[model samples]
Target: MTRRLSLFGATGSVGQSTLDLVRRDREAWRVGVLTANCDVQELARLAIEFRPDVAVVADESCYGYLKAALAGQGIECAAGAAALVEAAERRADLVMAAIVGTAGLAPTMTALAAGHDVALANKEALVSAGELMTAAARASGATILPVDSEHNAIFQCLAGGRIDQVRRIILTASGGPFRTMSAADMAAVTPAQAVAHPNWSMGAKISVDSATMMNKGLELIEAHHLFPVGLDRIEILVHPQSVIHSLVEYIDCSTLAQLGSPDMRIPIASALAWPQRMATPCAPLDLAAISRLDFEAPDEERFPATALCRAAIAAGGARPAQLNAANEVAVAAFLAGRISFPAIVDTVRRVVDAAEPAAPSSLQDIFSVDTASRAAALRFVEQYEHA
Candidate 1:
């Protein structure tokens, strides 16, 4: 029987990669639902291509355009967050939680609560509500699969091994666009320059996160939640090649690594077929052609995003949500030319440092921290703009 799937963020990089794989096996897969935030054209195109039972656009303003685009196509049309949540609980065997930021939390949790297996590509969802998410997964008996390359690698390596026998998991970083830039040079980098990742093509926000190593920091927090391990057990290594995705060190002093070309499809396909490997569209790694491998420690002094991420994870509760919100606001300001590129980390640090950690007892608690954090970040931007 073909497994039914619901894809959220159906227009983003991860969503597109997932659709590519699903389209290849249309005979063995059924596209139950597809959703996009505001990309009416793309959503309409996907609706035609996948022929899902329902198509949802999160932005209410784009509903008419999307609805008209799918007129007479016999597919159900819905709008806004309610539509997304409704899609989350529909007849989907698997849910791809690929929406970019913290905004993905609600619908993702909705899917988990409804007992659908989740292929999670959005690290912010896990970062923001790891405890709540995992608890819901446990209560509902739903599986939470990791779609990030680093976490996916660790998940693959941990197969058939006892968790207690694991020593450490080392997550590899591309060192992003600023690996070699001096601190003075980094301070003047424009948004375009920062998003220009040398090794991989990704969305702009994620690209900027990579440049500042905040992506790695968020992954660090994600690792803490995904694996039953302490923060000290997770190490970040700068591998400019992007060949070795991640490594798992065993208690017996052996290290196992997952290597591949810089392609998101490899990890996405792996998550889609857990306990069974499938053909990935990603190019095979050529060890003979690539003769060298390099590694370095992330500089906490220059790229303070790493330190800020660590502090947020250590603080726990709503701190991670606050960190994510502050970073998002700060990055947006930087991208809009309202702040220097380097000030992204500074703004996040100041906001998180000034904010008090709150115990998030419910989803509202998480949103409360998120709102206050954004406010703090905006206030920081205003002060900096006037300074």
Candidate 2:
């Protein structure tokens, strides 16, 4: 039977990649809904092409444009966060939660509560509310398939093997644009330069996160929850080549690594067809052409985001939520030219350090932590007053 799919964040990098896979086998799957943050024109175009049952624009102001565009297309149109959450919980067998940042949490929780198998591409959801989401998944009998390349690689390598025999889950990073830059040079880095990642083409927020190596840090929090592994068992290695997605080490000294070209579609395809492999149009890996693979330890002094993330994970509870929120605010400030690239981590560090620590027992608690962290982050930016 064809799976009915609802894709949140339809215009984003992850959402668009999911669309590419679904579009290839249109007859094999049905598009139940497509939701976007704004991009009404692009969302309308997708609605026209896919003819989904529903089209949602997360920005309420863009609802009229979307409604008018889909007037004759027989697609239902709605807007705002409420509509986005409703779309997620609507009649769909599978939900792709791709909305970036904390905005994705509510809708993703809704999807889980509605008992839909989630192809989770939003790392923030897991990082911010790991305990709550995992509990929801257990209670609702919902399955969460990891869509991030690193998590997906580790998932594939494990094959649901005995966790007790696992030694460590080692995640590989491409180290972004400033991997080799000195601490002083990173302070002068421009937003344009930071967003220009060497390996992956992503949205600005994630691109900036990549530049700071905080993407790996966020992934570490994600790994801790997704794999239920301790902080000691998760390791991050800087592999600038981006060939080895991730690795799983067994207690028997055996290591399994997943290799591929830097393509989101591969992981997307893996999530879409779990326990069964399908042919994706991702570029084939040419190991023969590239004979050598290099790996190095990430420099904590140069990129402090990774260190801050590790500390957050060690702190537990709402710490990850604070870390994620603070990082997002700092990255946005840097992107807006209000702060230097190096200040991104500094701002996050200050915010996380100053916040009142809370042991988050529920989803609401995580949201509370996130809000406080963002506010604290803004305060740090104000105090620094970087032009």
Model 1 residue 110 distance off true place after TM-score fit, in angstroms? 0.6
Give a tens-digit lDDT track for model 2, residues 1-387.
688999998999999999999888887789998999889999999999998999999899999999888887789999999988888888887899999999999999999988899999999999999888988889999999999999999999897467778899999999999888888788798999999999899989999999999999999999988897678999999999999999999988889999999999999999998868878888999999989899999888787788888888888888889989998899999989888888888888888878656798877888888988998999888877844
For model 2, what is the error of residue 284's alpha carbon versus the real structure, in angstroms, after optimal superposition?
1.2
lDDT of each: 0.90, 0.90
Residue clash pairs of candidate 2: none
Clashes of 1: 0
Candidate 1, residues 308-341, lDDT tens digits: the string is: 8788888888999999999889888988999998
| Model 1 TM-score relative to the real fold | 0.98
